[model samples]
Target: MKSLSVKLFCLLLVVLLTTPAVAEIVVEPEDITWTTDAGIVTFQIRFHNPDPTAWADEVSCTLYAQDFGVFLPNQNEIGTYDVPPIPPDSFFDVFMEIPFDQLPPPPEVHHPWDPMKVQPYCTPDDHWDGNVDLIWAGPGGAGTIDSHLGTLLVCPTYGASEIHVVTNCVINMTYTITGVCAGFTVQLVNEDYTAAPSPLAANWSGYIRVTADATVPIGTVCCFTVNFTCGGSTIPLILCAEACDCGPISNEDLDWGRVKSLYK
Candidate 1:
């Protein structure tokens, strides 16, 4: 996901370069890793404040699962947390989880081993399964300073101004899509319908297992194309994950109670 985050950051810089006074926020692991057991999935996000000047006074941070147009619950901001002052030249990690069962199942479910359902999205088999986005927010405003590809320091370059600007900074985000049967093939397709291989492990036509490593920064929209091949042919699926601020529960996102309820 390191590469993915950097790619997204560069794109954000070009798109939002006109925005005034944007603080640079860098995230590592553009995609989060997920592991599934039975019906449970757990994951972690590793982050650091490389710039002592920018993140010095960052009093709080928030994590969120953004909505991707669909009513599916996966898009909601699941967690928001507060933290103490972090020393300069230091790093921090936040652990979070997403329960597959917590969100409604896709419109259709095809067993990983089911060859008949493998080609549902091809030609006459177009499917409309919904997708969701993921994001995290901290004390820094939406802007970033220049640095190496994988450096941990994100030095602050600007300050907040009267401008209600939206700067989408790039950071690393990694996630593991687990619980699917093993030995199947998983591919990530973008909004443009282009497909790429998923880094997760799983079998064909049994369940969907995929891991995506991308460079994603905050404030950008990301669409995923998930494909699993069971009987030689490929089946296509789509999901979207966005980057944004997931402040405290009171920030008025999708629903904090529902997110916490699943943890119980």
Candidate 2:
């Protein structure tokens, strides 16, 4: 029996070693924060493909605060996206935005800090005690999972120094628009973009809405995406639609900050 067990173990090891590593989707969560309650909270997340071959998978997320582990509207979950297949040994980025309407308002806590620089948003403190889960989905389907543990971050700026109330610099970050669904186009727009130099800082931030011809059932969702690159990182912003009356969905007001250039 012991010999049989050893043989089975060796067989499983050999099978795993010989197969492509695309079964698991790994996510490295970056600590992010927001100041206002008017818009959605965006999470800067890094996703890696550990597979030896290219892979595309279905991804979704849920958010809960530390002090308040609350349920979101319309079934307590956020958006769902099918990421385009990534090459072997490569990774990409995505900005997961959970709408303010679907989430609990940030607790009115007075204190906020990070290990890096203690800066502004000092009054904004919330926690991502929930998780992002990825399951590998290929041409048909595969069997495996990649799950990031609870992201417990309470209102850390990740070391932001200056407060950008107005706009100045326009060409700092690179933009890439990836089409998750059809018939919808997205653009980057900054109302105050100029050639003149200004000040301070802020990274990728935006909102997106989808429009399509197909009718999805009520309680179902469809999503689209647009991504940008800044400081050698590719971040995809995925926006979704919730079916209210089981009809074709429409677009919402998408406002983006102006940038210098856009690439594939």
Candidate 3:
């Protein structure tokens, strides 16, 4: 019995010594932020690894833009980034600014009345949808992961214009326009003679200024449209403006003083 037990223990020890240790590694997307200005779009994404012991010697990401069939040769690579070794269970953020020249120009489409308009909207299924390919390598081996980053909406920029407010109040309103790849201008059109400032260019801060006519009287509302023109394409936004004091609120209207307090 003792000789048999000794042989069995030797066999188990040999098997344990020959087996390689498996490293647990995982990469995940944390957040993605996008900004556009002057017909250019920029993207910043944060990623992290969950494995505590394995370290990646290199990490890379590839970005792809999905365009409907209206544009020829869709699925283009917008940007790429490579980083040095990333420690286990650490976070990394990468930024890429896509130039205007690399962006696909707006496609010419038939008027809204034409049946061909349906063709432009049909094929790509999701004009703004995109994909990101992530590759990472460790001392043990290399692996790849992919993620569908959701809709980006870069072509033919337009936004929902329905707004409610009190009449005769100088209320300030801001709008966020997405998928604006080319330089564009925003203007209030057919406002029924409503007093408003001239159109402003869509910049990094997606802000549009709209003012109500004080003389128009209280308890009154005006419905109008805002036009976003870029790359020979125009998107008319139907806006319903009413009287009310909603107070000024916008993504760009950040209180830097208050932000500094948090750090202090």
Q: Score each candidate by Cα lDDT.
A: 0.32, 0.35, 0.38
**Candidate 1 residue-wise lDDT, 1-264, digit = tens:** 999999999999987875533233345434343444555545454445566544443434444442122112334444554434445566556666656556433232211122222123211212122232334345553321111000000101110001000111122212233233222223333322234234322321112223222233433433434333333433233333223222222322322211111111
Ranking by TM-score: 3, 1, 2
**Candidate 3 lDDT over residue span 58-135, tens digit each:** 555566543211112235577776756656777667787876446443222111111222234322211222333445
Candidate 1 or 3, higher lDDT? 3
Q: Which stretches of candidate 1 lie over 4 Å from their true place?
A: 1-25, 28-31, 52-55, 59-62, 66-74, 104-138, 142-264
Model 3's TM-score against the true structure: 0.35
The better candidate by TM-score, 1 or 2, is 1
lDDT of 3 at 250: 36
lDDT of 2 by residue, 1-64 (tens): 9999999999999998887644445654332233223455665545566777656454443333
Better of 1 and 3 by TM-score: 3
Each model's backbone clash number: 53, 3, 11
lDDT of 3: 0.38
